[model samples]
Structures are given as C-alpha cells and as structure tokens.
Target: MEHTQDNGSVVYPDVKTDYHGHPNYFRVLIYLLVLLGLSLAVFEFNLPANVAIAIVFAVAVWKIGMVIRNFMHLRYEPILIWIAVFAAVFILLAFFWGVFPDVSMVHRELAPKL
Candidate 1:
C-alpha cells in the first residue's frame, strides 16, 4: 500500500503495523478469562453484606484499571496523567470514606423506627 505524505511524496507501506508484528490472540483470551473470573467472584462468593460490598467494589476497581490501561490504550500515557488519575481516585475515596459512616449511622437510626 502507498499513501501521500505531508511533503507531497508517495510513501509505501503506509498502513500501521502491530507492535509485535502478529495478532494477540492469547492476550484477548486472557482478558476474557479475567472478565469471567470477575463475574464468578460476584456470584460464587457467599459473603457477609459489608464484606461482599467491599469485595465487589475491589473487583470493579481492578476491572476498570484493566480496561483503562488495555482497552483505552492508556498504559503508556505520561506520568502526569497517572498522577492526575491517582489524585482523582484518592479524592473520591476520601469523599466516600467521609460519607459512608454518616450514611450508615442514619440508616441504623432509621432501622429501629421502621
């Protein structure tokens, strides 16, 4: 294949090539397996309510990281981007931490009245 370049020249072999020069079938299979494992974690584990919530949240976070790094192609993004993401995650976690106790207390108080 040939393509016109910015300098008005024809460049041969213009199509982008894979980094490894081959299809990554194994990687795709592994990603599918990981998703299956996450699904199984949700249904297979019989845990206490609080512990189940924590486990599901942790698995969701891990799956999100995998999607961001692999599917979104952000694995090689700049360190600044990683720092920003981490900062956002930390702030959100802090917010959740601050709100959870108050919410739990409110629910507990309401439980007895109902």
Candidate 2:
C-alpha cells in the first residue's frame, strides 16, 4: 500500500524492502552459522573424497542462495533479474564444462603410481 503526499510523491507503508530497508538478519545469521558448522564437520567423517566434495558443494550452493537472497536482496527483485543471474551461472558452468574434460583426462592418464 502506498500513500500520496501533497508533493505528489508516493510512500510505501506496508511493503517491506530488504536492501534499503529492514532485513531478516536473524534468519540469515542462523543460516550462515548452520552452514559454517556443517563445513567444519567435513573433517569428522571418513567419507570418500568424492562424497565429501559433494556434501561441501551442496552446502556451498545453499549458502550462496542464502547470501543472494538476504544479503544481496535478490529475493525481492523481478523475474528478469533472476533470468540474468541464471544466465550468468549457465555461462560459468559452460566454461567449467569446457575446461573439465581436458583436466580430468590429463590427470587420469598422466598420473604416476605412488
């Protein structure tokens, strides 16, 4: 809801904004703490390297989302902004995909037996 002032400027009353307004800081802090704790737990288990990497990557993705939503105020943004962000992510993934096979193949074929 908005109210119009005598100067013809509009003021939003009930709408909550994140960046320039009050943010849900407590929730964000809780998420950060939880993710941090989980990351620190990575050394406790004797899981295989691949599984450990996957777990850490999952947590990292979640933490990134939380930071984007709360810290960057991306949750309140429009759909086009989301599309743009996703496009950037896709481009990054494509770059990594292009680089992965060469690295992996070289590592697999050229590794010296220990």
Candidate 3:
C-alpha cells in the first residue's frame, strides 16, 4: 500500500512553477509611507478630538480594505461577499449607537448624584 499526499501530485515533480511571485519593493515602500503618514496624523496632529477620531477611523478602514483585498485575496470574491462584509460593519455601528445613548445617560445621571 502507498500513501497519497494532498493535491494528489507525485511526491517529487520536476519543473514546478512557483505560485507566488517575488515581492514588489516599490509597492511595499509606498504602503509603508502611507502607513507612516497615517500614524503621524493620529499621534502628532493637534486637531479637534472628534475630527482626529474620524480621521483615524477612516484611515483604519482604508487600511483594512487594502489588506482584505490584497493580502486576504478577497479582491476577486463575489459581490455577495462584499455585501455581507459591509452589512456586518453597518450592524456593528448600529449596535454601538444603540448602546451609546444609554451609557451617556447613565454617566450623566450618576455624575450628578455623586
């Protein structure tokens, strides 16, 4: 009896093509620059609190999208998958909004009593 490996290809094959190519140094440098700029904006800027928070969140979302599309290989996924991803994001935002008011009211009420 002989054991078979996954992919069912022979244990040793000659002249196999590499699935992954070499990294592009230029593209990686550009990504690094963008990340550094975003980091600087978050930590060094003297913007209003809400504005800073919004900027950070926006940059984070952009970075996440980049990673999902490139690193996760989701760029070619179906539209349904994109819709599901966006729907989950909206649901999370709604959940936070629903809880924020109650939390704010509780803090306000408790602050006055204390």
TM-score of 2: 0.70
Cα lDDT tens digits for candidate 3, 22-112: 2344574588579758856685778888888888887777777766775654564568988998899999999999998888777565665
Candidate 2: give the clashing pairs: none
Best by lDDT: 2
Q: How many collisions per candidate?
A: 0, 0, 0
The 0-to-1 C-alpha lDDT of every candidate, in the order given, reads 0.66, 0.79, 0.65
TM value for model 3: 0.57
Q: Compose the digit string of candidate 1's lDDT tens values, residues 1-114.
A: 554443566656524652211224467458757875875676567777788777777876777777677665466456898899899989999999998887777757565654
Cα distance off (Å), candidate 2, residue 73: 1.4
Deviation (Å) of 26 in candidate 1: 6.3
Q: Write the per-residue lDDT of candidate 2 for residues 12-94, one digit (tens) a residue.
A: 76555422333568878997999989977996898898998899999999999998887787876779999999999999999
Error of 1 at 97 (Å): 1.0
Error of 2 at 96 (Å): 1.1
- Model 2 stretches with alpha carbons more than 4 Å out: 1-23, 106-114
Which of the two candidates, 2 or 3, achieves a greater TM-score against the reference? 2
- What CA RMSD would candidate 3 show? 9.4
Q: lDDT value for candidate 3?
A: 0.65
